[model samples]
Target: MTKKNVHTVPSKGGSGWDNKVGGEVVSHHHKKETAVEKGRSIARANEAEHVIHDKGGKIQQSNSYGNDPNPPKDQR
Candidate 1:
């Protein structure tokens, strides 16, 4: 399967998240929390990776729903 990533990133000119992939915006929202939830759902449905970014556009957290090449040290 083709691997895809869903991201919750700070919007360009507003307070929210820009769901993106490969630097392309796929969706937008007005609330980070909502966006994060949506991103998680999307990632789960697609069996992809969900990445959340902070207001500074820095990666905050990531969760993999599909096969991860390098999984975490702990499964718990």
Candidate 2:
């Protein structure tokens, strides 16, 4: 089954950050750290990926909670 990924992105109007699942906003936080924490929890629970975006809406990083199809070779 395809897991729905969670994303922490800059909110509209640029006031805060938002935790989104499957393109739907689940929660909002004034700080990016808080939003990332929330998003990580959701991603862990769902066994999905957590995608973090920069202020400019560009993808900054991502973490996989579920089984990855292509894991990095450097993983130990």
Candidate 3:
């Protein structure tokens, strides 16, 4: 199966946020939280993985939206 990854990254010049897919920017937001939410929505719609990064460009969190091979016990 193909992998879909939606990422929330920091925009240049310390302005705001950027949502990207496959290294291409898809949308820009004025807030990190908003960007994260948008990324989550995109991930869910596409059954992809959402990746959130810190301001320092370090990975902060990741969540699978759907088609998880090893879902949580509660979800299963």
Candidate 4:
């Protein structure tokens, strides 16, 4: 089964951040930090990926909580 990834993106009004799952907004926050934290929790719980986007609508970073297809070589 495929798990839907969670994403933290800028809100439509440009006033805050939003936590989205499969293109649907699940939560909203005034701070990006809060949104990211919430998104991470959701992704971890669902064993999905947490994707963060910049204000310009570009992907900033992504964290995988599930079985990664391409894991890092260094298992630090």
- What residue pairs clash in candidate 2, if any at all? none
Using lDDT as the yardstick, the better of models 3 and 4 is 4
Across residues 1-76, which tens digit of lDDT does each residue of candidate 2 receive?
Answer: 2479999999997899999987889999999999999999999998999999999999999999999877989856
Candidate ranking under lDDT, highest first, comes to 4, 2, 3, 1
Clashes of each: 0, 0, 0, 0
TM-score of 1: 0.83
Q: What overall lDDT goes with each candidate model?
A: 0.85, 0.92, 0.89, 0.94
For candidate 3, lDDT tens digit of each residue in 1-76?
A: 2467998999976899999998888889999989999999988888999999999999999999988877878745
Score residue 4 of candidate 4 by CA lDDT. Answer: 94
Compare the candidates by lDDT and give the number of the best one: 4
Model 1 per-residue lDDT tens digits across residues 1-76: 2457998998878767788876688788998888998888888888899999898878899999888878769758
Models ranked on TM-score = 4, 2, 3, 1
Candidate 2 positional error at 14, Å: 1.3
In model 2, which regions exceed 4 Å deviation?
74-76
Full-model lDDT, candidate 4: 0.94
lDDT of 4 by residue, 26-64 (tens): 999999999999999999999999999999989999999
Q: What is the C-alpha RMSD of each candidate to the true structure, in Å?
A: 2.5, 2.3, 3.0, 2.3
